[model samples]
Target: MKKEKQYINIFIIFLFILVSLLMIIPLVRNGRINAYSDWTFHSARVQQIYLNLQRGNLLTFIATDVSQHTGVGTFLFYPYLFLYPWAIFKLVVSPVTAFYLWYASITLLTLIISYYSMMRFSKENYVQSLIFAFVYMLVPYRLYLGQVVLGEFIAATFLPLVFLGLYEILWGDLKKWYLLSIGMSLLVYSHILSVYLSCQVIALIFAGYLILSKISIKRIKVLLYSAILTIFLSLPVVVLFITDFIGKGIATTFTGIAIEPEFNSVIVDSFRNWNGFNIGLILMVTFIIGGVIVRKNKQLKYIYVLGVLLTIAATSVVPWYMFSNTILGKVQLTNRYFSFGDLFLAVIASYGLSRLFDKKLDIVRKSILMFLISIGSVFIFYASSTWVLQETHTYNKELYLLLQPKKKNGVPKIPDRVQLDNNNYNYQFEYRSLTGSSDYYPIKAYDNQSKVDSILNQETYINGKRRKLIGRYNTNTIKYRISLKSKSRVDLPVIKYNHTEVYVNNNLIKNSRISDRGTIDLTLDKGMNNINIKYQPNFSFYTCVIISAIIWLLLFIYIVKVW
Candidate 1:
């Protein structure tokens, strides 16, 4: 019997792995199975960290962007999510290898999360878990952001773990809720927005529990321990927040205005239409209604009702426009911003399925529902998989087009002054000057243009106010004069000091340096000063060996203590 049980366990694991592979195949075929977009930046930052590791460095990567005041971008960094798997991968491989390793692992974890949550929250067998996991993997939001590598994916892994931990605290033998606390803390550090939404969900759960049951010392102890432990575990994210707390305040004001996206009706229809009319969700809905009719588990009525409400809210199909506008729109659109509704959907589906598949189903009824479910599955798989493939191919074509080298047809001239706008969307820009040479000069432009592009691929709630890109493109031409109105301080754009000349009040400064950002310490009288910044990449290597070493040392100590 023991041997048989072991074999069954192995078989179940294999089945789960197979289900995960089914979900991954489409993403892999699209050439964008890995995280793309803002993920590229995070990946690059991970690469930078690896570079530091190669040189024995440990400090987290820092970024600069449109909001220069008070280091606005630094607050968003979360090191723990990136480091957990990174440290393990670092043992035997290069940094890039480790980064991909983590990416792949997280993808696998998403499936595992579904399986584990189903097991803990429902009485489903392995097969049901596999089916549920498959459906969850195809969730539109997950697929949409699959290419955008960000902390959200990693952070999402903890959802099931948190649910399971909570289950243990409520009904299992786990006396200490420390493990759940750790998972909750990890969520906080993974992505604050995800954590914030998740916490609200859990808060609702606690509120429901409070209404239903008399408070016990054990329950209060569990709650207090979980909260305290979570806070302690989330210290890394807290510290980073404190570092830029002031900047976040400013960012909040800037992003406060809510803008609604207006797409054409055709686009809207195309988005709503799923490939084979995924009836799995529809069947699940039917089952939910059926459960209501049968009145199964009255204790869970709150979950069923709340889940249904959240599903409507998530899809923006709810009749209450005021509630949707004030709450959902303020958070960003319903579907895009919160996929946690998928959790509630899963709960309703699980409950409904348990009822539908119970002993009472006659042959004809079971067969018919199964057939419809299969058809829906096939339709959804084909539609979503095809879209993923097309998106990948189109992105590849665009990247290839952008990368093709072109022969210079004219001489390139340096711009006298650059004026950048602080609400532009597109990042594609052009620099033209009739006097400018056609010769290509690579200078990394630091403006709002790059910042917006950086965050486009991911959903991020920046903690500070920021400027917008002035235009889609920056054009410089030979016939036009570059002009600027000076503020209290004139910050000279640092360049390679090649052929560019600077004149303050008609007096030419005769000094040059390798610095790309030069500061003008001299007080400006009140009006206009001619500023020219000409740059050519001299490929200066930024050495951070000392900083890296100190960071690595601290990280090492932290790891040793934690482990």
Candidate 2:
């Protein structure tokens, strides 16, 4: 009987997954990806990871061949260890297929993860648990994440686990602290800005909980332990960010924090912008009705109220223009609050429905109907908005075309480098290309057009007074055959930071090799010489990976033992 119940649960969960996946079928069949936002950037990242993995470069911190082979340190700050499996999947599949497969995998994992999270919270209320997972995954904004596929989307995938862990720490079982750690660790691995955004929401929840109940020392300990464990697990990426941001003169990479404040919406969306920038009608009605119908659980009440605060934040209730340059503006985008806000509302809505409908049949029936409604609404909104955007916004149409590049030799090809280098600069290229992103590069290097132009037009890579060399090179290493008039010290236009290495005829050139411009500086001997340049994020990153692996191993063992 127990086994039968478990089997039924699995079947239903899969049924929901299949239904959700149906939405993307047309997209996959037509090869028309939702070229909405940030997909190009993620596409480049997956490609780079795949290339590096093929070369046996498992830890690909820098994309050597992207952006016309100038290289970019995208992986140093972006949380991408989760992308490794998809990167590996590229072994047998085409780039486009792998991209879709990876997205499908995200959808699969998110459904299961969310199911487990709510299962624990609802105490085996299978109908409520499945609905919670279903609603959370299909939240309108999350559907946007599904299309454009931002790093924040990846981070958002694990939010239920984070909520579950928080629930355990505050009101539920404290023994499940590991769930919070794992969730946060994955978030850190997914997107750092998301971590920043999520931390703010967490602070709100913590404060709200404090007002309702006294903080027990035991729960406090669990919270602290979970935090510490997250820090340790995220040491590799966190340490990389810290060292680069603090030690190096890398200026802030983001410029569009509060750029789209007007796009923020609540309850009724005036525009069908499906990019996680709105509060859907279903959620608003669900929360309002749920708040009135379910009055039993105080925690639910707090969550109900918390959802209001999040809505305010999501809708920009606070005047954004005044805080444009202030710390509040650093949210990367104001609409991002909806990423987690909808979670609370979904929980309340599902739990309320479960409680209100006395029979299991009614709960299942309502949940399915609501799910279908959401899907239909999202499709109409997305299709209508896209048509409106094409008619009203010419820039988006151009961007839509630019982002969905044509394939060359079974893979997408970046446009000609010379043409792009000479003609114009597009911000969208920052996500798609390897070079000139100015993200982690030293600030002053690309501070102005002249400087950027100089970097791009530096014809001779060797920058010595009298020495000149030229040859071909591949990812990670550059091989150059040079005939020098005299032995002269030279700088290569290549940018170097964080465990970059230079070798001349198999000799390591350490200390005093990097120039002020973050270029590779080396002395060339008078003769035909071969030079090799390599980058392997050394000791510190290696140690963090090892230590974090061990800690996670122990954590899983503990979870298994306790279970």
The global C-alpha lDDT for each of the candidates, from Candidate 1 onward, is 0.43, 0.65
lDDT for 154 (candidate 1): 65
lDDT tens digits by residue: candidate 2, 160-274: 9988898899889877878888888899999877877778888888887787789798898889999999999888887787665576766555544544435334445623334
lDDT of 1 by residue, 1-563 (tens): 45643553455455545444554455444333222334433443343344345555454323211111111122234444455465457556644345445655665677667666666555535335645655665555454544453656566667666766675676554553554775676677676656766776777777777787776679668877787767655654564445433342213211121322222321243255332112234334532473564366664566556555554444434433465345433443344323555554555554555454644555445444444543454457557557545544434332321211222331121123221111110011121221111111112222242432222211111112222221110111001122334443333222222323344545655663322121112324445444332211122211223443354466457647864
Name the weakest run of 10 consecutive residues (lDDT summed) in model 2: 416-425
Give the lowest summed-lDDT range of ten residues in model 1: 471-480
The TM-score between candidate 2 and the true structure equals 0.83
The residue ranges of model 2 lying beyond 4 angstroms of the native Cα positions read: 34-36, 242-245, 263-267, 270-276, 287-290, 355-436, 456-475, 487-489
